[model samples]
Target chain A: MSEVDVVRSSSMADEHVIEQAPQSGTGELDALAAALRDGQPSAVEGIYDEYGGLVYTIALRFLDSPERAEELVQEVFLAMWERRASFDPMRGTLKSWLCTMVRSRALDMLRADRRRPRPAYSLDSADGDRPAMEIPDPSRASDPAAVVETRAVLSALDILPDDQRETIELMYLAGLSHSELSGVLGIPLGTVKGRVRLAFAKLRQHLGIHLEVES
Target chain B: MTTCAEWEEEYLESLAAGSGPSLEVLAHMESCPQCHLLLQKDRQIHDALKEGVRVVPPPAALKSRVLSSIQTSPSAPQLHVMTEGSSPARSSRQLHRGSILIARLAAAAVILLASGISAVNLARSSSVTNAAVALQLPGEPVTYGIVQVHPASGIAYLANASLPAPTPIEGHASEYELWYIPSGGVPIPKGALVEGPDGQWHGAVRYPVQGSGLIAITVEPAPGTMKPTSLPIAAARV
Candidate 1:
């Protein structure tokens, strides 16, 4: 069904509630887009809630500076707010869009910084002498209920062949495109797509889950 | 044309979007029980993930900082209704015209270069055997470093004698890729390498910048390839 049809057919109450809720995936993205276009503040909040971590994680990974990461996060949200009108649902989902923006900005910062010589610290050098901070295994659980679910997802991810997992992480977490993935992974584009496909299939089989696509 | 796997992946991608699949994928999905069942399960997993992915509240100061930055920054081009104001529209048109004039001037210069006898001199002067000649990063402070250029072979070597090994991600490996952005072309992929086991890495890439003038290094996933998927960790103009 067309987006207009979905928006119109859904009851007003349902639409309003969906607008307020943090979007999980693309449906929430569409709803968020609609809300932002309508100038709804709640939609902005929903977007932040849904993608703030992803953005923060990416920024932190690249910047290695928490302060810079936080700064980039704020910049991303501002960019999102300003560019809301330009977001076209046809091109890609909001998550992908947000990620693209975050990555571009981060890259710009990185390139800019390369000219300046900054003091460097290597985490690897800290080695045994340093106190070991509890490394949060994103795969490990902290709580029973939510942790179990997270673990299941991680387990499913773990079962994927190495190539597939690596590709998925680079594409989803690291924001690499198919061509970029091929470049980073040193594999053919066809191989990248194949690995992604197999990865998705394995995730589905292991988790017994299917992703829904909005027509 | 869609294989079951493609259809399934597309369907899942759509679900991630919080919607149903494309008409083509969905049609196949409707007729195919395996795919249909897969779709149902995908929805459930997505719903479960919604709850599992906790939304960390943004820092309170971020809003104020963002708003302040926007306010302090130069105003972007403002769209004015024909009835609201004439000044903005006039200014906008003038800006557009100015840009066009500048572009025309640039094009004319290029044409002149192509047609003029000076073009030979230009070509000769521009021809640098080592396109990988190390140049400082534009607008950045220059640090003491050595950029080795093998102009004849089109190879550039970047060595940071005092550079430190990049810190690894908590749970993942980290590596670097080199990029050579040609003077007027797309950035070309060089190769990927990590700092030596002792916190230093020195490497060379087959330079694609035959006539180009820049070299850059970007942190990337291990097993690097031709193009960069991530941002440059360091860059210098060659």
Candidate 2:
């Protein structure tokens, strides 16, 4: 079946919510961005207070090191401060732009670590000291909507078949390129791409109306 | 010509994969409102997926550290100073002060160079023929020993460290081995390692490692295997 045909066959988009593009900020975020352009130290604190957790979270998930994640957060904010003039509020929201910056830096860090050979998951050699993945407390999130979105996203992930979920997470969260995903999963490149498409389809199905809702 | 539906799927996939749209797709989005709406819908998916990753608040000190760094940095935006002009007389006075500052900076650089030379001489006394590169261990910081690779001597020296000795698997003896990993090439086993005096590990291996290669310590069921059996305990670039 054609790709659109398949999408239509699922009957998922019938209930899809059409989310509006996050409008450029005219208020606090704009002032913060303007202040950052002028190298205002207070502006650094403002942006950090708003997005520090999200930046740190992406780094931690990709690198799995608290120290490295913290360092990356600092680096991202500093880069944003230095390149504040490049930010165009008309193109996208500050939050989306910041997320892109975090992903770029995190992916660069991962590549610098080199292509890892798959570790032997032997019982005797497994690292027992590895830290558990941190779970966010909605109560502590920046807003109530964030809490609901977090819960909803997590629920969507839980419903995915194991293989598809693993591939999707490695591709998106771990910052693995399609080529890297092929090598890591020991699957052909076509298969890796297929798995990703299938995973996204399922996410669209499960997250239909919820995905459309702006947090 | 590709259908809008196909272009939309490709656009959504690229964004969710943390990549921007291609030039052709961007052109299409610009002229087509339907495609532009598709782009917004893609953003929604991207944002939703991002939330699936758990958030960990950064260390409380990080904010202050960033602020202090930008405040003191030489290249930090002088936008305020440039935007608010001063009188020509005041500017001339500032220019005079800048000259004095440049002279002082030159003197400081000379002193720093002298200190660096002395440190290099001190390192030369030991077999460490080159500057030491610290290996980054994931998870907790290295608590016990430090790992450094000396390219000049073709040796990786492990100082009094706390790496756990390998445990033998059933019917096979296991040992930690060192390998030279070249950029974009298979790993070449350097040699088998034995704990040296004071629980250190050192070895001279015969691998022609490139400038951008890595030295890794891996556990193997037996030495001389072409491939490693376990993940590296530590690794540093040459």
What are the TM values for chain B, all candidates?
A: 0.36, 0.37
Which regions of candidate 2 deviate over 4 angstroms?
A: A1-26, A115-132, A135-197, A200-215, B1-53, B77-238
lDDT string for model 1 (B1-238, tens) is: 5578777666655654455668988899889987777665655555544433322233433333333222222231211112212332233444454335433433332332343221111122221211121222224432322333434334444433234444443334445556556556555555544243344345454454357544555543344333343444344444
For residue A118, model 1's alpha carbon misses the true position, in angstroms, by 20
Write the residue-wise lDDT of candidate 2 on A16-72 in tens digits.
112222333559878887787666767877777777765666665555555455556
Best by TM-score: 2
Tens digits of per-residue lDDT, candidate 1, A84-192, equal: 7788767656766777777678778888768321111112212344211112244554544444544465446546664565456546443446655565456786677
TM-score of 2: 0.37
TM-score each candidate: 0.36, 0.37
**Model 1 RMSD in angstroms:** 21.6
What tier of docking accuracy does candidate 2 attain? incorrect
- In Å, residue B82's CA in model 2 sits off its true spot by 17
The superposed Cα distance between candidate 2 and the true structure at residue B120, in angstroms, equals: 18
Q: How far out, in Å, is residue A115 in model 1?
A: 15
